[model samples]
Target: MCFSMFRSKSKNSSIIQPGKFTPSNTNINPTALNSPSSRSHSQSKSRSNEFNSKSSSISSRASLSSLKDSLPENPHIYDLSEIRSATSNFLLRPFSSSSSSTSWKCLIDKKQLIVTQRKLRRPIDNSELRRKLSLLCKSHHASLVKLHGASVSGNYLYLVYEFICGANLSDCLRNPRNPNFTVLSNWISRVQIIAGIADGLDYMHNCAGFKNGFIHNHVKSSSIVICEEPALVAKICHFGTAQLCGEVPEAISGEDDDDSSNYHVLKRVGSAVGKFVGTRGYMSPEFQTTGIPTLKSDVFAFGVVLLELLSGEEPMKVHVDSGSGAFRKVSLIETAREAVGSGTGRLRQWVDRRLRDSYPVEVADGLARVALECVLEDPGRRPDMGRVAGWISKYYLESKTWAQNIGLPDEITVSFAPR
Candidate 1:
């Protein structure tokens, strides 16, 4: 499904260090990672070092050669002719978007690749864009799609990424045409997929390149893609909306409310007055009306994704079938909270029916509860990506789907199939 397009972790790799927290930052929004439980703190630190080493290894792979043969224009900027040549006269264009991104499947370095170009819809701070791009390029994690490089070509910014030959999570979860439609419905796969996503967010939030502030800003089912490497690796891909808020508090805490846990905030960096951005169903409520995005805001959107994953329903249009053929719209967040609030009784109402009740009700309830925490109106109350990752990893290791367990790889693009 190339948009003129385009492109996970699984049983074979651990992909997550259970109970460990990584510092979360990406001005797109910030999530806090609590200290690992005392008993496993040392183990968590060891794993963190391993992941940092891997990040350095992947960061070293950005080939300057790719930029050397630049499109006879600005070396930092790509020439339209070069882009056209790489894309075979622009043969694989997916669709056009004035504000949205237009992607293409391209042949580069003798391999299939995904190229995305976006024209700015609103004025974004130039320095913020630079900072975001720098961090974006440095970002390398097993659970995240590798960013090959990016170039400025006229008004549209061009980004190159490794192509994952598969469908996004939304399709795999419910698209009738997806081969994964069956496998993804199981509780094990569901938990693995969500856990894998949390790992990516954990990496982005707590890992390097975001000393400033950065948030995925865009966290949704469509942003998640699953690779069919038997391990069914899931990776987070889109970053067009990602922004870097200049400076923010590393950690904030208050004792006034029960939500006094130390949480990170994703505050506006450059200007207080900025347009709100993000998809409708995925945008955090505060960000929606006031146009402010924080790491907590991104958490809210991620919670929506989890809710969708659990119920197999869109957050905005969720509905239940009526005996008379009429239907009632069900608010995904509110409904999930209510279902989990009931102590797992009638929790079945929120679980996706496609599982046929084969999925574990208990785990389903856990996911709902986690999602409830994420979508809480007070961003401060939302659990940080670190906590979310730990929760998912706990369930992922406990889930029965995986046969072989391996650690997250230094280079996710490396083939993971056993010899």
Candidate 2:
């Protein structure tokens, strides 16, 4: 009977009931499980596990934040369909008739942007194009028009830039309806415009930190816009068009003789197809010959623009000879050289008469001399954009001081009464 009772007890222990707890069957102690000290220990263990989980979650979030910070801010590569939809199937009229490239002012994602269409001069690899776009988009300056993004379709690229509300330097300087009137009426206003442009160019040449130096291939009065309200701010347009459209020649570095020669031939042929469209008076002698744009060429264009700012005249115009009644081309550069060389009051006379003798003669002379230095026939002889910008900045300060001393208002306001 004792042996049978022991067997029954062992069998009952093996068959554990669902809701019944036994210390012999389970590793847990029944007395300790219900004790206050044991319950305290259990609560402590649960709290510690919860604290560790929170810490792990915070650590994971920190790691993810760091990863995001390390990555570059890549520009949006838009789908062709998005561009088409925004542009209403390409039926929108161009923003400006004078623009060499077709551009449309359209809204995308509730933001106004200027979309310029450019034909690709050469095929670019997809990865390589994205890399270049990222670098270009990363560059920013107050005086530069921001390139938001780009879209590609087959052989064309649509570059989107933030639309700035202002008049271009060309129209501001010369009003078609009123030739005698100019929005840049005062000397201080003109100084402000040129100074902003100089600062912007200096940033692109020296400070942009591009692997290959950035070049603003199109630097003309027409390509610069002047924001009149708030302040006279100059913003350069077409910041990365050259690189994006493959207009920048590989021979720009002068690394290979054969490549340079081939680039010249290609540029000459491509000019017919609108691949190369340099402004009439802005092209430097070297740029005209080699068809390769460099930093120095940009300096040359800036010089021309400076002269246009100083003297309210077209870059190139026809002067009819009184003696023979024959038309001959008279370049502003030639007149500027003569005015500076004459050593008389001719420079003062050469300056825009609309200034009404309000500007400081000394400052004007110095600025003209700086412009001349930039237009030297030999690109090697011309000063770099950095040096030129520094000179202009100094002149700008002097002009401001002159304006203040003379009690000339920094800005001119125009109002019209109802006719």
Candidate 3:
């Protein structure tokens, strides 16, 4: 009977415990130990401490797990359909806000949609990007493009931006139908453009603590957009490839090539392979060689852009159709040399044929000189954006004076100073 009673007690204990276990030394059931009446006061106090410890540990783990979920693990791609629908089919809609990093616009339903898909495997350390974007959004200026808002959902990010409705400076230069096509943009317009660009750059350099290292890197005909005023409104875009002002090689990509023919072709032409990180002809020699991009690097690209505006020829095109020989491989600089060697008046011949009849030669010459100085081989020798802005402004003022002195028709005056 004693043995039978022992077996029944063991079965009862198993039923009560289920998955939970009590120490052999503890005569009390672990669950029962928690009840106030089941344990002595001292034991009850100890049991409470144990329960609190367990609860605290579980709470900490849950908090940590939740924190991890908030960060994006990868760049999430959305269906193009989703993007289209969210954007209300890209139909005309007003946006309450905008940002350059992503596209946001109103849809038919009047709800705003942000479209940004992260391209990189790792998410951009967004703290820096956010800080910069914030600064850009707050500042108001003519040259800088406007920023609206940012969208973040999981790994998806979108930047809403104001849509600019005008031809990029490059399109204006290359357009055969543009009446003002070849003339060096009137001295006034060029100056205004230059000054406005400087103001934007100045703010970028100093106001946001963004001085020194970051460069627009890609300055070309297509980069600058002209507004209704026919103003050379510089819309600096594409910060994706921007080099950090003070960081290591981790920030940039490296490429390798060993084509002597390509090298020879570039050398003869006074430009680089013009591939990879920057536009081929516009990149500085240093950027081509060492990846040492900086403010001076941007100045070099800007100089090339100015030259294109004046000359109306692609910087690398000078080498494109040359007759077979070392002459065929002649670099842009050499090509310019050959053209100039023809005569002092030959410089006028090199200007875009389209603008030949309309542009003032003196204005063209001045801008050309500025371009040359901007593209100097030594970064230190290149003029700062401030100086360039000032020079352009002066030229613009002088052109206005020249136009008035000649008693040009009202159309000419209005064209020079558009409302």
Candidate 4:
């Protein structure tokens, strides 16, 4: 059924044959169609198609390799030859901007490079750790951060990545008095960001490779970078503290706890010590009280991030009960509940004082629901990250669709803009 080409002679002239034409006896080699002086026209087309198929297969394999090699612990170390070929003799220069203990520069060839080599506080061999990271990197969707390429030399690693130049979500919330503060992020953006974070986590836990259960052990403001667009893109970063599930023994099956009160499951059962690990405010209640760490614990940390994004205040700093210092605060969720309100309605005072008249009630309420859901004490009660991502994406789609349908002004873009 494969139609091809041929040359025909009409009296004194030669032209391409015009009709359904397939090789009658099939003598075509199907590889040299590109040759300038192929004697048979029919053979040329067949050969061209064969070359295309082979090229496509090679492209697919290359893509698979790219996805496999970028894990943090097992970074795809690029051989000098490959890099030289990609960058046309490695004549690239460093980026000019430097901040936050890392120097970020774009290569002349348009590749982004991050340069930092903090002396490892502890030395460890983790090739297996890098493989687990590969699993996490490959499963990313819109909600998750993208991992590009990385290199290793002794204890130092050079992580080359897609450069996202945007301020962390905290800056906007912290400086409400600025002109840009007037265009302050709304509750909708918060919901979208929170939902995206949850989805990224869910993918790591359930749908990723057989051994991929990554608990982003650290989730905080500095870690999330918001993109410059509507429906804010929150990219999760800094996996230095991440724990890959399969590499270590699974003490209780991931499905061990159906009961919400079973904090005991979070306690480390084997040789691994489960002490005070992640960032303070974001740490789960179970992990804070008892040294138990689980996927739910990560969820709890995500909930704290969600609350901070929505309220425009650090979760731990929001509810001050007279005597307790800012750093020595109690449960963020409890304080957020009191600040946002109890049961029926929200408290106006609890809203970020800086938001002033800008924050809308509906958006705030929606974020509250997402934040509360993420922070629920029982792990079972919390929605999985996939479900969270779906809900967030649905909300985003619906908002855009509604605006389009009603002909509302599309003035809202998620990036930080001046009032």
Candidate 5:
């Protein structure tokens, strides 16, 4: 009996040894742990995990690249030396030269660009100038020419723009070589041009995200270009000229409080002091009197341009009185008003003879009325650009419907040669 108890105790001690493997204590298989097939399965799983890790890294990199591409390109600030080098140290012949500004079409960094030089009207610090430039460069629209960048050399601010191949609206309308012919010969083309200008102006006045309303101090036929390749599209130039040149006052910059009282104060102060600069005939009466460029002034100028589009004449013309042998200034606005006030037949007669009386007379009459409202002497009485754009859009649709009913072709080939 003693021997039997000792055997049972020795067996239990063997089963319960700390390092000994037992079926109930552990699930490891000795054969599976060392077999070639099991080793192959373990290696396969390790490779799968490694591949998944690499795939995750690749996916992460692709996502980062996509995000980088989505962001807007930052505006370039060109060095003065670079501008000088591009223009051959200011020896290159200017593309367009005027008393107030000069432009040069040159290659910069292998990209074609138009560099315009204008005298700075006021002194701005580097920080403020950079801020203004950043804002200007960020704003983009199909109807507005893009401002690539700008450079400052002493009192001159050199504005760089993407070189667009097109003719100015003034030259397209009134070619000196072909006085009787105009590129905007069709009624729909004229309507399209005015509608585009109205939309661009409305955007500048109300939808540009400007804290204060943007004022285009220069709104004239010469400031617009007509692109005729794929389609007839009008692009407004000198988009940020007023702001950069300090033609806009601090009160109108939206830097101060935005309120009617402040605006009234600005008008009074602007009228009371400061010399004004603007294209003749396009300037509103208030702008002429107060020397303050305002949103209403832009509207007045747009009205004049619209009338010019209708009449196919310059904004202001000198007519010699055959009877009196005296020169009289005949305003397009006056003629438009007279034509609309008289009757439909008078308006039909007043419409650009180039159209050959193809346009809808009623639509023309309504457009003339709208233009008159815009040119009203009182700034307060004139409609805002938003309303003007709305009217033009309505007229444009009407004109399109009229064209379709008449089976007029959309495209009309015309000479695009520069005057």
Candidate 6:
């Protein structure tokens, strides 16, 4: 887990009330994100000023090329000069409002690409972090965005990914630039969105190589981007906060922490501020207390994203009628549980109104039930992402076009073959 959660509550008190929903209560400024737009270069000065200064004696390109040699052979090590030239001087288009990394829409050999730049908050052994990065780069699943190249320096690390030009799921659902962009309309599509994400996480947690597997650590609605170019599908991006299981530095986890063994898997996450890196609402109660993340933690985050997709609400803020004043801020998880407990009419209040008559009541009920189990306060009680994937598959397969829309071949298999 990378970010802070429940700072005001004590370790004991931070525990989830048996059946309450808590929104990821971050004071996020949503508009700070530049909406993934591509623009002409204000970045040109970066080549002469930034890289030139960084590389005074030898060429900047030569310095960057040397860094590239250490990584797995596939990804190119572009010179800082090349990157600055491509992005017009490191003027980044925001990827997410909360993202600490800066990104630019770049063109290489006439192909449009997205390059993200980040600096390590603390020094990490280049070999150790690079090995993990290479695993993700090589582990290409359709739902996982492809890594084009990378440059990992102790000061600043560069990551290049395929730019899925479509809007992120967060913007597409709640604050869509176009009111007509109804890609998230029906139950099948929404279910497909959840399934696609589950598939990617399944692969990462199980298939991605690590002695203990990898954890996305940061899973949320905004982290998911929906692509419509070749087909309609959702993909996860911004791996800047993700970490390998059981590899946390002792200093970050604190040797005296009770969950120290399980907490071993964390990263300093490139922040001078030194707080945890994940959103509060999506974090599992145990992780909030212990600072240790397991595959189950990711499952909990997915559950929150599922709730967001189902309800068409932001994970950070949900409104409840306070009776005395304006709608008070209630956690989305708490609201979800209450909505499910109360009758169908109450549930409808939380459901995204945009779906209108398109959603099937039985399917909605099934989703709520599954999602409820996912957000369970007890980590052991939560289903693994593999089983989570299975639970949502049958309902999604009900739509034949759905598979084709997400670019899955005909006769696709929906079960998770977890190891």
Q: Whose TM-score is greatest here?
A: 5
Best by lDDT: 5
**lDDT (Cα) of model 1:** 0.64
Q: How many backbone collisions does model 3 have?
A: 20
List runs of model 4 lying over 4 Å from the truth: 1-75, 78-110, 115-130, 149-160, 176-183, 210-212, 229-232, 239-241, 244-254, 257-276, 289-293, 318-332, 339-345, 352-363, 393-411, 414-419
lDDT of 1 by residue, 1-419 (tens): 32212122322364566897798886632222343464376578889999998987777655555556541222122356767788767676563333567777777657676777766434444455565566676655667776665655446567767677666777766666653344465566677678878877877777746653356776888878776555556778765345422222223322334545535544443454645446868887778776655677778889999998888877777456666676766577877777777766568866887776765566677777888888988776788887888887776665553323323222223222344
Cα lDDT of model 3 by residue, 160-250, tens digit: 4345545556655565676555323454454445545555554454443443334555566665655543323455543323432111123
- For each candidate in the order shown, give its overall lDDT on alpha carbons: 0.64, 0.78, 0.51, 0.54, 0.79, 0.64
Between candidates 2 and 3, the TM-score winner: 2
- Please tell me which model should have the higher lDDT, number 2 or number 5: 5
Per-model TM values vs. the true structure = 0.68, 0.76, 0.57, 0.62, 0.80, 0.67
Q: Between the candidate structures 3 and 4, which one is better when assessed by lDDT? A: 4
Which 10-residue window of candidate 2 scores lowest in summed lDDT? Answer: 1-10
RMSD of each: 15.6, 20.8, 24.1, 13.1, 21.1, 21.6
Error of 3 at 50 (Å): 72
Candidate 3 stretches with Cα past 4 Å from truth are 1-85, 88-118, 125-128, 151-157, 176-195, 206-209, 230-234, 239-276, 318-344, 357-360, 409-419
Error of 6 at 391 (Å): 0.8
List of clashing residue pairs for candidate 4: 73-130, 74-130, 95-105, 180-418, 229-414, 230-414, 266-292, 267-292
Candidate 5, RMSD to the unseen true structure = 21.1
Residue-level lDDT tens digits of model 6 in 269-388: 543434455575888887887665667788888988988888887766746666856766678888888988997888887888887755666667778788888888877667777677
In model 5, the Cα lDDT at residue 317 comes to: 89
Tens digits of per-residue lDDT for model 4, 206-321: 66664435566656776666665443455666443344322123455543355433322432355445334446577766667765466667667777777776656666654455
